[model samples]
Target: MSKSFERFQRRKLISSYFSVTLSIALVLFLLGILGLLVLNTKKLADHFKEQIAISVFFKDTAKQVEIDELQKSLVMSEYTKSAVFVSKEEAAEQHSEEIGENFLEFLGYNPLKNSIDVNLNAAFVSTTQVDSIAAEIGKRSFVEEVSYDRPTISLLTENVRRIGLGILIASAVFTLIAVLLINSSIRLSIYSKRFIIKTMQMVGATKSFIRRPFIWTNIKLGVFGALLAIVALFGLLYYLDLNFPQLGVLQDLKMLAILFSGVFILGLLISLVSTYFATQRFLNLRTDDLYY
Candidate 1:
């Protein structure tokens, strides 16, 4: 009968430890996901910004040699990602395909001008930067006009700023919540062992001597929990990369390393701090208070 009771107590203690560790692991996994999004925000924004292009139309009187030279210059510019020259004939064909009619046939002439479509680097995709570049290009003698979607650029910039700010704020709030959750889990785990703690104190054990084992054990559990979270985080990232290759989810190894390291350190720090305080709480309690 004594052996049976001992077995039950041991099983209960193991179950409690497992529950606490699993809870910590789940919380850290969620925090890891938020960190990933924060790190990749700039990369995602740049990908979209690179898609919009500026079109520089040429005057009919402009010589082909001069037009080609201008396109070459634009391609070589620091601000340009790429530049493609489209002749009037090619533009007319593309327009006809789009509108499902050969407007050239109806008008008896092609109205499109030869132009260079310049895709700017993500850094220069803002409305002001684009306007400055376009103005400079419009001053060229061979250029008839420089045009792009100004409203789209402006709106994208504003939306990206707002979203980045929102994510940062959310990250801050989640971090605080994670700490509180981990601390609560540690406190609860310690609570179950309050009687053992008071007994050690009554047996003339020093507080530090009592705390060393509990602190060490909890820290080890924190490490295990952090490792579990990291494994899950990596698994999720791998799944995302495999299924959605275009998202390039795992492209930045350095950021991922930093994020994972942060999770491990956070786990260790929170565990150490919470364990110290929890043990201190029980240590300070009177023997009479222990019953309550």
Candidate 2:
């Protein structure tokens, strides 16, 4: 071969390698994002559920001491994440602030009852659990009523379940697509060197000898791709933490570590497997089939 032709071949090889690396990085990046969503789905749901509180209103004759005792018991309960005692005056003030009017002034009496606002743990925020908790609390002698937005809890539970299932399904589909995408890129890369592979085989290169370099090179490609994807994923998390701090995207360090590690492993595993199978396909083909 002329030096110019060899140079052309070299450039083409480099170009194909670059494309494969980029393709792996892009697919892994998307998978990383989906993985993030999957890992944080429960957290997102819990945040909203925590916002919905169970209001335990006291009877008119209930004393502050009794209310305090009940509130303390609730705070110690496993289902309760937090419990705040709201006096009738405080409830009236909140209502007034919400409506932009002093209803107490218009009515000449404060009719609001003293209540304990109970924020439940995420696990107990569903409709049935909340109702059961409320019923259990209502049996208290000082408790007049135990109330929460049953309809809101029901809707939230349903929507969260649906959304979580949808995300899981999407993650599975995307994972398969990522495999196919990376596999195809690897196959195309290997296809370019099929003739060389056949030549080596003709010269008594064992299957392992023929496969070693391709597997190693693609493994490195996978590592580079995974690293690139990780960097992009970190950048995204940083942006989210900066702009949407409420999401607490960076709060869970352990889960983040697991996610990042999974990304790295997945990248390496997929690339190794794809490259092996792709090269094997060409290795098994006849020399005459190279034109196809």
Candidate 3:
């Protein structure tokens, strides 16, 4: 290549390198956020589930031993995550405090029954699973009644399901859009050097030899872009940690690792594939078509 030709090529390469990296980083950052939401959706759902506790009120005649056994049994059950026993006196005191009056004293005696507050596993938080679990638990001889707000559980499940579906659709659409934009941008960059590709081919350069440099350059750009995305994601997570401590705790390291890996792989794959096709297009084009 002449000194002028070499200079032009070098400038084009530098420009394309930075431009592509920024473009990729912007899209990947958005993708990282979406992936985080997708992962945390389950955590948020589980939090809502935890709020709908199963209150297992004991029968008036239930012996202390039988009540304790039932609490232990529920704690060991597949559905239960935790179970806290509330004595009749404690329940009465709690009710009195809520109303800012000694209702037990005014009523002449405590009326609240001993109960176990059970929290179910996230997997069993749905309406169907909860209903089944409640039915099974209610059958016990000591259980006077098993109660929870069915309407609240149903609302939470329905809202979460709908939101998850919407998010999934939006993520797929945005991912496709990002891929297309990256592809077009890469193609435009390569299009500037169609003549150079033709020159190499005419001078007996093998296709792989011609593609190697471009591929290597884009690979580096892809990695750098992915790193940028990770940094942005890290900042957002840090902010969440500072502001919303509870939600921040849902940021599992394993899930974050998977998301970062996904970003890197996505960036590398898109760059490599786009480079191959863009390079191949010029390799196959007729000399005169370089103008078009």
Candidate 4:
């Protein structure tokens, strides 16, 4: 009977350890997916910002030298990423190609004006800054008009802002819920060993002494879970890259490294915190409460 009872206790201990490790692994997996989503969303937003172009139309009488000077000025500006000059002839040729030979014959002359297309740095892509930039460029003597898709820029800015804010709020809410769920899981795992805790307490074991082994066990399991999550995330990214090379920018080594490091730290912190609190609660529990 004594040997059978000892065997049963060992089995229970093994089962409880597996359960805790599995729970932590599941939580880490969920967090990893959420992290990837947030990172990719940010990259997409930046891509959209890069596509916003500002068109600077040159005056009909504007000389090549004046246009060159204006291009130099724009290139030197803090807000500009790049300035590309499109000569009137090039613009006319492009329009003719699009409309075919018939349209050019009817028009008689190239009415397309010379223009400089300016790409702004992502930081200055906001609606307010875009308006300010247009106004600044309009003051130039060679600039007939400054044209940009104002409605499109405004829509992009608002959408990006709202998406970023939504992601932040969702991340916060998910993190809070994850922590609570992980804590509950850890508590239940510890509860399975309540009798052991009670016996240790009765024997006058110090709280630190009772907690050290559990904390160490949790740390190891947490690291293992995080590594598993990292592997899963890398696999997903690799698959995406293979299937859609257009999104290859997201495969940047630096960004992936940052995300992996963050997940590792998060996994360790969550496990350690949950273990500490769960163990503390068990340690302070009344003898009667142990029955539950």
Clashes of each: 0, 0, 0, 0
Which numbered prediction scores highest in lDDT against the true structure? 2
Candidate 1 matches the true fold with a TM-score of: 0.93
TM-score of each: 0.93, 0.97, 0.90, 0.90
Write candidate 2's Cα lDDT for 1-292 as tens digits: 6999999989998899899999999999999999999999998899999999999999999988888888889989999999998889999999999999999879999999988899999998888898899999999898999989999999999999999999999999999999999999999999989999999999999999999999999999999999999999999999999999988888889989988999999999999999899989999999889998
RMSD of each: 1.7, 1.3, 2.5, 2.4
Error of 2 at 80 (Å): 0.3
Model 4 residue 184 CA deviation (Å) reads 2.1
Which prediction has more favorable lDDT, 3 or 4? Answer: 3
- In model 1, which range of ten residues has the least summed lDDT? 247-256
Candidate 3 local accuracy as lDDT?
0.88
Colliding pairs, model 2: none
**Prediction 1 global C-alpha lDDT:** 0.92
Across residues 55-150, which tens digit of lDDT does each residue of candidate 1 receive?
Answer: 999999999999988988888899999999999999999999999999987999888899999999999999889999999999998888998999
Off by over 4 Å in 2: none
Badly placed stretches (over 4 Å) of model 3 are: 1-12, 249-251
| Higher-TM-score candidate of 2 and 3 | 2
